[model samples]
Structures are given as C-alpha cells and as structure tokens.
Target chain A: MLFRNILFFMGESWKNLFRNGWMSLASIGVVAVTLFILSVFVLINMNVHHLTEVIEQDVEIALYIDEEATSDEREQLVENLRNHPEIKKADFVSKEEGLERLRDQLGEENGLLEGYENPEDNPLRDAYEISMHDPEAVSSVAREIETYPAVGGVEFGEDVVENLFDFTGVLQVTVMGLMVALALTATFLISHTIRLTVMLRKREITIMKYVGATNWFIRWPFLFEGFNLGLLGTVIPLVGIYFGYESVLQWIDANLKFFPSLIPLETAMGQVIILVVPLGMALGIIGSLISMGRYLKV
Target chain B: MIEAVNVTKKYNDGNQALKKVSFLIDRGEFVFLVGQSGAGKSTLFKMIIKELVPTSGTLKVFGRDVSRLRGKEVSVLRRNIGIVFQDFRLLEEKTVYDNIAFAMRASGASPREMRKRIPQVLEQVGLKKKVYSRVNELSGGELQRAGIARAISNRPAMIVADEPTGNLDPQTSMDIIKLLRNINVKGTTVLVATHDQQIVDELKKRVIYLEEGRIVGDQEKGAYVRAL
Candidate 1:
C-alpha cells in the first residue's frame, strides 16, 4: 500500500470506530473487562508460583536426638546424616543453642525462660537442623532418620509441608486453566462483536466490490479497525492492572510479609504486554476475516 | 472490446437469463443494449464487467477470458471499465470529490494524482463547483453527473452504464446521455444498458435489441423497436 493509502485507511478505520458508536464501545468494553480478570489471575498465578518456589528451596528437616544418646552417639548420628545423599547440610543444634533460638523467638517472653537457665534445668533436646538438596525429598529423608536409634522424632512440619505442596499444586493448575479459558472466551466474544459491525457495512462492501477495489483494498480499513480495537481494548485493562497491581503488591508486602517476594511491577507489566498484545490483535484479525468471508465473497 | 460466444447464464431456479448470447463490441464504440425489463440487458453488462460469469460459454474482455480471471485479476479487469448505475450507487454521505476519488483510489491512484485529476473529470461533467457537495444533496441529474464523473475519473478504457438516467426527467435524462456521449467521443468505448427509447431513438447510436434472452436485432445507428 502507498503511504497515502495507509493514511487513508487509518482515517477510514478511525471513522469506522465511531460509525456504530455503541458497537465499537461495546467491543472495547468486552476486551477490557475480560482482560481485567485475566490479568488478575495471571498475576496471582505468577506470584504463587514465585512464592512456592522460594519456600520449596528454603524448607528444611529437623531431627531431634533422644535424651539417652551420649555426645559421641549424637556426633555419630550427625556424621551419618551428613553423608546421606539427599541431605545438603546437617548442622547439629545443641540443647543450649536450641534454647537461644527459642529465646529469640520469644522476644519479651524470654524472661519466663529464666527458669531453664541452669544446665540441669535445660530440658531441650539436641537436634540436627538439616537442609536438603531437593525439598521434595524432605519427607522421605525425615522419615528415614526417625527410624534410626538415636533420633527421637523428626519435625519438618509434616502437616504444614504436605498442605503447602497440595495447595500450590492445585492452585497453579486451576489458575493456569482459568487463564486459558478466559483468553479463549475473550477471543470468541471479540470476533463476534466485530462481525456485527462488519455486517452493518454489507452494502458498502458490495459497492466497493463493483468499484474494482482489490480484496486487500476492501479489507485494509477493516483490518486497521481490528488491529486498533484489539490494541486499545487490551491496553486499557493492562493500564488498569499497572496502577492497581502496584498498590496490591504494597498491601501484600505490608501484611503477607512472610510470603516470598513477588514479581516486580516492570517485569510483570512487560510479561503481560508481550503475551497479551498479540492475542488482542489476533482476536481482531480473526473477527474481521470471518465477517469479510461472509459478506465479501468477491 | 468484448467478445461473447454463445454465453449463457442460468439461475439456480432454472430461469435462463441469456441463451446462447453472442456479440462483439469493438474499441472506442458506443453501443446501447435495449430491451424489456427481463431481456437480459443487465446480465450482459454484468458479464462484460465480469460481475457474473457465463454458465457455459466463453466471454472475453480485452482478449482474456473473464471466467478464467480470478481474485485480483477480476478487479484489474473492472478498473479498466467504469460502471455507472441508475440509483447513483455512491458513497452518499461523502462529498462529490470522495465519490470520484473512490474509483480512482480503487485502481490505486495516488493522492497527488487524485488531487490533480478529480477536478478535471468533475469539470468535464460540469460538476467542478460541486466537488465538495454531499452526494445526497445533489438533484437526480447532478447525482448522475457525479456518477459519470466517478466513472470517467479512473480514465478507464471503457464505460458501462446500467440505466444511467432511469430516475431523471426527460431533459435531465438527455443531458446525462449526452454527458456519456461526450465521454464516448473522447475515444473510450461505452456500453449502455437501458429500456429508455426516447434517448435511443434521439441519439441514433448502434443499438442491440434483445427479446426472450436472445438478440433479435442489431443495426448500426439502430432505432429502438418499441413493444406493440
């Protein structure tokens, strides 16, 4: 197309955008509303995947030593556990050192722990605070250690760990499935909406057909409308998400401080744009193509 | 230049619009296809522009088979032949300039060329002063002139007008035919399909008469034979 033709088509498409004012507005509204929900889920899915990853890497297993185990036996247990293939690090926490950590967690309540200050009064057991190369192997490794004679109990938060794994697994799949469904529904809706606008121009298309206009010439203006509508529709929601997600992240930071750090604003925005803009454009293209196929047989 | 050798078109309902129709139109010739409402005049004109292909026989325009033309090839064929319609099939809400520019742009005329040529054609059609007037604002004659201006604006090798003056008064109708005659005199072939006997008898041009889906008469400077 000539530069002038492109400019003409752009002007024509802009006019078409307002030709059926309510129809165009409705099309844009559909895209914006659909993408708004889509981006929220996409964000949540990303953050959950990120947070679970952080937790998975940092979770460790703690093995408690029996009171009857002598210092030498405790040393042997630690040595044997360190040699375990799945164990990354098996540092021993003595009863006194364990008391120190308890006091740190207790904060102002540490004065109540003064009763256990004497050596004989210390009732805490020696434990091996073990980290693993693979967090998935934590349960199996802890269970095996519990069977050893020197190990009294293994506490890597069995119930909490199982539930966290279950929750992350289900949430990841469900959110991902929901995102795909939303995108498909949005595309289907936008295609049909644009078809109505194209239908309104059936006679105009017939006139163009007889005017010796090439199929491409007849299609260019509509395609331009589709491209721009797609662009504007998807961008509107992304803009909403851009401002909204920032404060939402702030709230999460203030309250869910224990959760792993999330995707930053710029990265998340870039990701959505990259994934979303083309989909939006495709929706418009498919829509106009289908409409034209019916009315523009020439 | 069009050649139709036994061209036939049958509607799906088995109505035979044209039966073994054959005619040859030379370059720079002005021919009027005159017939009753169902005499297949419009269908012949459509075949010339490749809007409707023959059901069986070969119809050639500019020495190429029309039915063989595909996609953009058909558009290229139409660009060489401008068409004017009775109802003034135009972008009605747009200015007279846009209506003419449409045909020019369809053939991919540049902005510079359109700027330079639109006025020239409009001037030739006596519409120079009304270039920006909306099409719906024009009188019947003026609308037909705008239609003629658009037809000639592309500078096609030929012009095809189907009932070009159907809605105009007798005087306006003659004016439109003369305008088309003026275009034809400039050495472009012109084919007009109409039942208007007044202009046909008055103009004394070549007339091809059709009856019952076949050409019943063909004469140089032929007179329209009125139905008894």
Candidate 2:
C-alpha cells in the first residue's frame, strides 16, 4: 500500500512538473541560481578559513639559547618545552645552520656580510623555534620560555598574530551570518515559485479536496514536485562546482601564488557535494511545504 | 445522515450566509434544496461537506460535530459524503476512467478495487463507452455524468451535488437527474441544490425552499413555489 502511494505521488509530481513547463523551468531557475550563489559563498568561506588556519600554524616563539649553555642544558630546556601540553614541537637550530639560512636568504647580498661569516665572529644565536598546537597559547608559551635561565631572548610576531586572530574571528562570524541569510532567502524564493505552481492547479486541488482526499494525499504529490525541482536545481551548480572548482584552484595556483593556497579539491569537493545536494533538496521541500499549507486549508 | 441546528454563518465581511437554519436529512432520503441564486444553497452545501463552518450552531454528519472536527477528521467526514460541483471539476487532462479512479485512489482503495469499482460507477452513470475519453472531449452532459461517477465511486452514504445540471441543456439535465435518481435508488442519500423549477415540480421529492438565507417553505413531495 505504501509502495503504491509512493509511485502514485511520484508519478503525479512528475506530471505536474512537466505539465506546467514554463513554471517548472522558472522554479528550477530560481533554485539553481540560489544554490549557485550559496555554493560560491561556501567556497569563499572555506578558502578563507583554510588561509587563516595556514597563517595560524606559522606562529612560533623563538627561544634564543644562551651561547655558554652546555648541550645537556639545551636538551633539558627542549625536554621542558616538550613536557608542556600546548607545545607541539620544539626543534633546536644551531648557530651554524642559522648562519647558512641567512646566507641563503641574502643570496647575492652575502658579499656584504662576508666579514661576519667567520665562525669566531659569528653573531647568530642557537635557538629553539617553539611551535604551539593551539595558536592562542603562543603568548603564554613565550612567557613560560622566558623564565628559563638558559634562554637569552624570546621573540615572536605578537602583533601580527593578534591581528590575524581578530580578523579571522570577524570573517568567520560574517561568513556564518551570510550563509544563514542566504539560506532563508533561497527558501523564500523557492516557496514563492512553488506557490505559483500551486495556484495554477488550485481547481484540481479544490476538486481533490471535495472528493475526500486527505491532506497528505493532496500534499504528497506537490511535496514530491518540490523535491524533484530542488534536485533538478542542484544539477547545474553541482556540475559547475565539481568541474569548475579544479580549474579555479589551478588558476589560483598559477596566478595567485602569493596568497595561501586553497584546500585541495580532493579534500574540499567531498564536503561541498555532501552539503549542496541535501541543502538543495531541503530548500525545495521547505518551499513546497509552505505553499502547500495555504492550499490545503479548503 | 446529516443534521444542522440553528446554523448561522457570518462571513468575515459581516455578511450572514445562513441565519439560524435548522434541518435534519435522514439516511437514504433524496432531498431537493431549492433556492434562488444567493439564497444560501451553495453555503448550505459547503457546510454539509465541512468546507465551511457554521458561525454558531451544531452541524453533525455521520454522528460527529463537523464544526469542531480536526483536519484529519474532516477528510474522514468527507469520505462518507461525496460532493459534486456544478462545474464538473474534472481534471481535463485525465480520462473519464481516471477521473472516477482518482476519487477511489484518494481514499487508498487498492488498485484491484479501483479497477473493479471504477467501471461499475461509470456504468452506473451510463458512461461506460466514454471511459477512455478525456474529460475535455466530453459534452456538457457527459462531463457531468463523469463528475457524478467520481462522486459515487467511493460508495458514499450521501451525495451532495450542488447545481450538478446547472450548465446542461434541459434535455441533458433530465438525463443527469435520472442518473442521480438511479444512484439514490441504490441506497445513497442524495441532496441536490438547484433552481430549475420545471424539474423540481416534475420530480416532486421533498423540497426545502430558501429565500434571502432563510427557509421559507418545506414540503413532502413538494412542487416548486417561487417567492413573491
């Protein structure tokens, strides 16, 4: 019995969708545009979040080791840093390696620093670059590392980290608010579109009501119609997003190298596809339900 | 089968469609609710089908107070009382067979039952040959017959047809009236609201006459009596 009704409603829904061709197209058009806009926002938000995470991961406190300190003391300091739960990794950089890094950075400018290249005259310090698993803990870790007697100095980009945190926080809130507003607007548009379709069939609906059809009996086909429309609307966006995302990613990689790279398509595409289809269907269903409430009142 | 006690319906615009009307329609009786246009005949039909609620009275059908019925209960009440509109109200795209079958399908009758009952109802309404024809292709009388078939397909206890033959020619109207009479003979209570005085006088069934939303005359085997 249930199976029969499912087929009946499905068939009726399909018929209604096609019978009113222009209206159905109009409905699908609205849904597609809404979903496309929503997908664009999601992609932008996801990339922005990814960029923030990358910047946060780069925050590190550099603890300058005392030149006279013994290797055992250095090892003990490393052990102490690692014992702190917030410290992700503490790697020691010797003065020689630091000097080599400076030379690489200077490139042709190394000639200017030739006099300071001698091992006896080397001014670079042996330091531990302390990485924190939680970026918010960077200042606390820097303060704790400063108490070490063997530490000559502690340095990190405190102002840069704070600004980045504040900016990302605001961006996240704004992105979330935009997504909610877009969802509501999309639902409302879809409902209005479906309501037009319902209005066109008002006579059939009134006749159905007169002939003893239950509210669900009258409602299910329309609901299915909305679901199908939503599913149809998702098609263009999914095609655009799935195939388009890679090209956009490649373009960014080629032209926008200075900006942090977006999350790989392989990593991000799955989440997007999962979200878009269901969201599209939900919008369609909600819109149809809202329209159905008016007609079913007899 | 149906009872209305002092049922008064005041519209949102403050127009009173029915004023303190009281009547009881017994089971298996054919009734003619004769009235002029705007005499509240349509309103009374709407009330009987539970489409319109009485403003301040108890209206019951099948022993349930319809004015207080919930959404689900309304459909149940409607299932037992078939309603036919003057417009024929058939889905023009659907065939005559599908039109009648549609009603059976609404109440969740099995396909086998639908297949069996649909032809029977169409035959009962004398539309056996027009079963596969689309409703738009049918003439005025044929469409009305299909509408009546759809109404009686569920074997309802009562059939409330509001101006069923209002759009038909006099000859065709007589045919449709006879079809309804046959269904009444088969034991369904039939209530027809019409303004055709010739047919009303000819049939001479019990008549309740209305004028300006008030019942002015009630007679057994009544003739059509126009108000002065």
Candidate 3:
C-alpha cells in the first residue's frame, strides 16, 4: 500500500510537471541560474584557499649564522630551531650551497662575480631557514632564534606576513558570509516558485483533502516535483563547470606557467560535483517543503 | 450515527454562528436541514466533517468525539462521510471517469479497485455512457450526477449534500433528490440542506428547520413551515 501510494504520487508529480510546463520550466530556470552563480563562488573560494597555501609556504624566517662559528655550533642552532614549539621545519643552508643556488638563478650572469665564486672568498653566511606551523607565529619564533649564541642576525618580512594574515582572515570571512547568504536566497527563490505550481492546483488539493487523502499523501507528489526541479536545475551548471573549468585550467596551464599552485580543473570539479548536485536538490526540496507546509493544513 | 449536544460556534469576530444547538442523526436515517443564509447550516456541516471545532459542547460522529480528532484521525473521520457542494466542485479539466477515480485514489485505493468501481458508480449516477466526457462539457444536471458519483464512489456511511440542487432547475433538482433518495434506500445515511420549500412539501421527508442559529422545527414527514 505504501509503495503504491509512492508510485501514485510520483506519477501525479510527473503529470503535474508536464501539465504546467511553463511554470515547471520557470522554476527549473530559477534553480539553474541560482546554482550557477553559487558554483562560480565555490570555484573562486577553492582558488583563494589554494593561493593562501602557496603564500603560506613563502612565510619562512631566515637566520644568518656567525661566519666564525664551528660546524658543531651550526648543527646545534639548527637542532634548537627545530625543537621550538612553533617551528615545523629548520634546515641549514651552507654559504657554498647558497652561492651555487644564486649562480643557478643568474644563469648567463654567473661570470659577473668571478672572484667571489670560491667557497672561502664567498661573502654569504650559513643560514638556518625556519618554517613555522602558524604564519602569525613566525615573528615570535624569529625573536626566540635571535637569542641563540651563534646567530648573527634574523630577517623576515614582518609587514608582508602581517598583511597576508589579515587578508586571508578577511577573505575567508567574506567568502563564508557570501556563501550562506546565497544559499538562503536560492532556497527562498526556489520555494516561492514551486509555490506557484501549488497555488495553481489548489482546487485539486482541496478536492483530495475532501476525499480523505492523508496530508502526507497530498505532499508526496509536491516533494517529488521539487526534487525533480532541483535535479533539472543542476544539469546545465554542472556541464558548464565541468567543461568550462577544464578549458580554463588548460588555458592557464598553457599560458601562465608561474601559477603552478592554482588548483587543476579535475580536482576542483570533484568537489564541485559533490557540492553542486546535492545543494541544488536540497534547495529545491527545501523550497517545495516550505510552500507545501502552508497548504498541508488540510 | 452523529450526535451534537449544546454545540455553539463563536467566530473570532464575535459573531455566534451556532448557539446551544443540539441534534441527533441516527444510522440509515435521511434528514433535511433547511435554513436561511445565516441559519448555521454550513457551520453545522463543517463541524460534522471536523473542519471547524465548536467553541463549546461536544460533537460525536460514528461514535467518536469529532472535536477531539486531530491530523490523520480527522482524515479518518472524514473518510466515512462524503460531502457534495452546491458548485459541484468537479475538476473541470478531468473527465468524469478521472473525477470519480480521483476520490478513490485519495484513500489509497488500488488501481484495479478504481477501475472496477468507477464504472459501477458512474452507472449508478446514470453517467456510464458519459464516463469519458470532460466535466466542463457536461450539463449542470450531468455535472451534479458526476459529483454524486464521486461522493458515493467510496461508499461512505453518510452523504452530506449542501444545496446540491441550488444551481439546477426544478426538474433537475427533483432528479437529484430522487438519486439521493435511492442511495438512502440502500442504507447509507443522507443529509440534504436546501431552501427549496416545494421539494420539501413534495418529498415529505424528516425536516429540521432552523432560524437564527436555532432549530425551530423538526418533524418526520414534515413540510416547510413559515411563521407568520
């Protein structure tokens, strides 16, 4: 009996959808447009998070060791830096290796500083590059490292790190705020549109009530109608995101080699698919449920 | 069977629709509810279906206190009683067969049952040939007959026809009363609320007459009485 009722509701929902083609189309269109806009924001949110990770990698403290210090002293300083609570990693870079890295960067201009090529003649000092778990903790960790005996001087971009933290905090808050607002707006619009379909068939609903239909019996078809509308709304946006994002990633990969940290379309789309389809359907269901709640008083 | 004891309905705007009105309708009984516009006939019908609760006193239908029924229980209560409106309330877009089938569908009747029963009820209402005809295309008399078919399709214990003949001519009205009379003969209780005094005189059925929300006259085989 329950199964038959469900089948009947589903059949009725399908009939109503086709019977009111224009209204159904209009409802689906609303969901599609709203979900498309939401997907775009989700894409932007992923890229922003990716950018934050990339910039976080650059937030390291550079400490120059005293040139006269012994190799044992340098190793002890590296050990102390690593054992610090805030520091995630601490690695020693010899003066010779630093010069080699500089030369590699200079390429053809390596010969411009010919006399300084020798290890003994190299002006660079041995340094301990420190990476911390929290970007905000970098400054405090650097201050602690400065008190070490063999440390010559400590340098890290204080203003740049502070600004990065502020920017990331504000961006995260704004994106989250926008997402919640958009979700609510989408739910509201979809529900109101579905309500139009309910209003059109109110007479039928009343007749059903008069004939002793359970409230759930009357609501099942409407809920299914909402689910169908929500499902249909996601199709275009999913296609756009899957294909459109892939092409954008392909173009970026070809033209912008420097931005290797940007999330690839495949990875981004995995999240999008999981998020978009369910969100669209949920919004659709929520909208329909809200409208139906009013009429189900019968 | 239905019982009403000291039933009073007071709207939020302070208009007392029914004041200390009480009556009993036994099983297999045909009753006529005759009243003017504000004489509380509609309110009484609504209370019987559990649509509106009486502000005071008790109403019991089928041995259950109707005022206490809630949600699904109310639907359960309504299923045993069928109602017909003056306007027919047929879905104009649907055919006569679909309209009758829809009523059975509401109560979770199987498709096989609907198929078997729709034609039978249509035949009873003398619209078996017009089964596939759309409600909008049917004559007023045929439409009322369709409404009757839908109401009796479920075989409820009682049938309430509120001014069923109000929109029809005298000959058609008599035809509808005869149809209701036939259903009553089959032992399903029937109640007809109407202002047509000529039919009341002709049929000589049990009549409960009301004025100003009070029952002034109730007589078996009664005529429509007007106080000078």
Predicted structure with the largest TM-score when compared to the true one: 1
| Model 1 C-alpha lDDT per residue in residues A1-298, reported as the tens digit of each score | 7888899889978888887677777777767776777677677667766766666767788888898877787777877886889988888898999988888766666786988998789989888889988888888888888888788888875566467568768876886777667656655655565576567776667667777889898888888887777777898889899999999889867655345578999999987888778877877777667666765565
lDDT of 3 by residue, A104-172 (tens): 655666785589966779989888788888888877888888998789999886665457568767776
- Worst 10-residue lDDT window for candidate 2 chain B reads B219-228
Off by over 4 Å in 3: A14-30, A48-167, B226-228
Q: In model 2, which regions exceed 4 Å deviation?
A: A19-167, A173-177, A248-262, A294-296, B226-228
Estimated TM-score for each candidate: 0.87, 0.77, 0.79
- Residues A1-298 of candidate 2 have per-residue lDDT tens digits of 3899999999988988887787778778777877786777677677766766777778789989888888888778877887989988888898899888878665666775788778888889988888888888888889988998688899986776567668767876886776677667666766766677678778777877877778888888888988998999899887888778999988876655345678888777777778889988998899888877865565
Model 1 regions lying over 4 Å from their true place:
A63-88, A92-128, A133-136, A147-153, A157-165, A168-184, B226-228
By summed lDDT, the worst window of 10 consecutive residues in model 3 chain A runs over A253-262
Worst 10 residues of 2 chain A by lDDT: A252-261
- Residue-level lDDT of model 3, residues B1-228, one tens digit each, is 989899999999999999888889999998999999999999999999988999999999999998889889988877888889999999999999998888888976788999999999988989999999999999999999999999998889999999999999999999998999999999999999999887788888899988888888789888877433
**What's the lDDT of the predicted structure labeled candidate 3?**
0.84
lDDT of 1 by residue, B49-108 (tens): 887889989999999999999998998888888889999888887899987777788678
Model 2 pairs in collision: none
